[model samples]
Target: MSWSMSLTSFPSRIQTHPTIHLLRPIKPTISSPPKFPNLPTIRSVQGNFDHSPITPAKTRWETMLETAASLYPLYVTAGAVVACLKPSTFAWFVKRGPASYSLSLGFIMLAMGLTLELRDLLNLFVQRPFSILFGCAAQYTIMPAFGAIISKSLGLSPALSVGLILLGCCPGGTASNVVTLIARGDVPLSIVMTVCTTLGAVFLTPLLTKILAGTYVPVDAVKLSISTLQVVVAPILLGSYLQRTFPAAVKFVLPSAPLFAVLASSLLACSVFSENVVRFKSSIIGASLASDLSPVLCAKAILSGELGVIILSVFLLHFAGFFVGYLSAAIGGFREPQRRAISIEVGMQNSSLGVVLATSHFTSPMVAVPPAMSAVIMNIMGSSLGFFWRFINPSDSKDSPKVDDK
Candidate 1:
């Protein structure tokens, strides 16, 4: 019944197969990763390798998945373009209404949970509480504030402003974990920060949205809290529990989880994009505040000035999050790797969660647009930053030890 015993009980196929490869390493390790209690032996993500033998077909399959996952931003971009041009393709995901978005988001969170080790997250916190907590605080404080400022400066429509702020208030996205790995940063630090901020979002997201975005529309904080629990907390907890209880089963599917999550995330955002495009085509761009959705864009809205403003706002919001996040982490005296981890964790957000909350709760189609847009923009920005850091040298202070390059 013990965790280790359960892990040891993995079927021989899994024991021999090494069923996952989440990253293509910046530098592959010589030997298979050591089984550190605090670390999962993901080959590239943690700077380790799986020297275990496997069939050629399995290797090719994993390579394709890894390549696909690495190009996640492109997939998101393509999905958005498709949503803009052929909105009908994504109509099925929205056929069930907002409930569909929530379900898709829940499934993605579950996938994220299954990939995680609860014990590792806990031990990470016990050992490095300040860095994680500081990063979480910045995630809440910095981005939400940026959302407010940018919207005001850009004079975004009320619905769009709310969408932007809500996007900011949501927790760090699960995507940051992979980006952190690519950046050659402290993957454990990034993962722990993400977990902390997400749990915290159940409270902070609603409260902050109420404060920053309340003027634009009435925010029922209580309803928001309950929804967050249902769509976000519940699935993550269930997935983590499943991961612990059925390690082998989870392991069997781990190889494909990230790729699946990537596609699902793209679909969710594209669903919103298509919905807003429909709303725009129906001449609903400037609907009254009480109406269903104050539409932000149409099929041709990409050429419109308002769409330009929305893109600029989203870009500025994330750019500031990345900039301020790194500067703050450096100020906090973290090393280069930890700084990059904190920077990424603060910069990228759970924008899909933002999209769901905006669509499910807010009436304005425009309210969902910012977060949907964010889902695309943040990934592009984060991935670029990760690669930029990855190519550079990360030199810690002479006295201090190098942070978890494992």
Candidate 2:
């Protein structure tokens, strides 16, 4: 139960109960890396002036935006609940055209790409190839496998099963980067892992979804691959190129990019939920009737039937992913921050992508439900984990420049 025991041990310890207390006690002192002679001091450089001081207005604005960004879980939770209650609120986001899913996802991918630098990817592979490869491998393998097992164990319908499995096979979410930053984990590694898994999804997502979900329904791997390339790969590369070619424009857009992506993802998930509200209401009623022994138990029964199973199954899948991912990285001899990065990367699936793929490729709207629900659940879980680690590991401050560098 000591920090020195290596992070791989978390799975075993947390299996009985995954909670904040599972972390070891540590002094709240910051840990510093070894110092070298005559190293240059890092400073933020703005184009206008050599000695321009930060103004109160500018600081307040930055603080306000950061506060908003950190409340992502709140926004997502509210959005999901509203979408379920009144479909019209989010339905318009998708009704504009057939390409709504693709456009939303493309914009999200473009925002992610703008944050990345080519050297960041290269440096990650060159410096810590094992961690990157291990994370990507776990991303494709562990979650997909867990998804199928959890789906079958829960005895979900074929459509729901496929949706859950598709979610499992998807890439690490862009939000994982922000969560990693909050958790004081290896941000560079998180970003690199996200990029690697996302690019790898072009091949792995379609193929794995076909292999794992084909039994549930017909899966056209070729179509999925093409769609992924169009929605994901192309936009990301375009944005990355844009960042390099037009640094000025990128600088202007970079501050708002993460928030935009977060909002887009929330809107996309809400839109899907809105589209399926009728079916959802009917299912809730049916499930409640099936379990209720008397009229008095009607409300309670709905909480224990189909909806309950879906929520439980999704929770187990992600909890297992976060635990197993940490174990895997610990086994690979990585320490605290890298293990945290891998855990978050593996656990947080790109739910927005899952929603798009399920709805676009599958005939049933029900197939999109799990992913839509996941958009809410994963953020809550990720943010909780981040804040927990942030408290215990005070030494891993967010202000450290090394956290941003590979």
Candidate 2 lDDT tens digits, 1-406: 0000011101111113223343688555544545555754333221111112333343565556656766778888888788778878866676873388889999989887887776656754675676678789989999999999999988999989999999999999988887877777766667788888889888999999999999989999999999899999999899889988999998676767777777888888878877877766787778656866466576566656677777787898899888999888767666577778889999999998898888789998878889988988898998899888877673343443221213
Relative to the true structure, candidate 1 reaches a TM of 0.79
What would the per-residue lDDT of candidate 1 be over residues 1-406, giving only the tens digit for each residue?
Answer: 0011011111222142233457565554455644547734333322211122233344777677767877779988999888877899987888976898888899888887787677767765776677777889899999999999999998999999999999999999888988987888877777788888888888999999999999999999998999899888888889889988998998788778878888888889988888877655444344323244435433334334566678889999999999999988877777777888888988899999998899889888889998998889999999999999888867534454333321
Worst 10 residues of 2 by lDDT: 1-10
lDDT of predicted model 1? 0.79
Q: What residue pairs are clashing in model 2?
A: none
lDDT for predicted candidate 2 compared with the true structure: 0.77
What TM-score, computed on C-alpha atoms, does each candidate reach? 0.79, 0.80
Candidate with maximal lDDT: 1
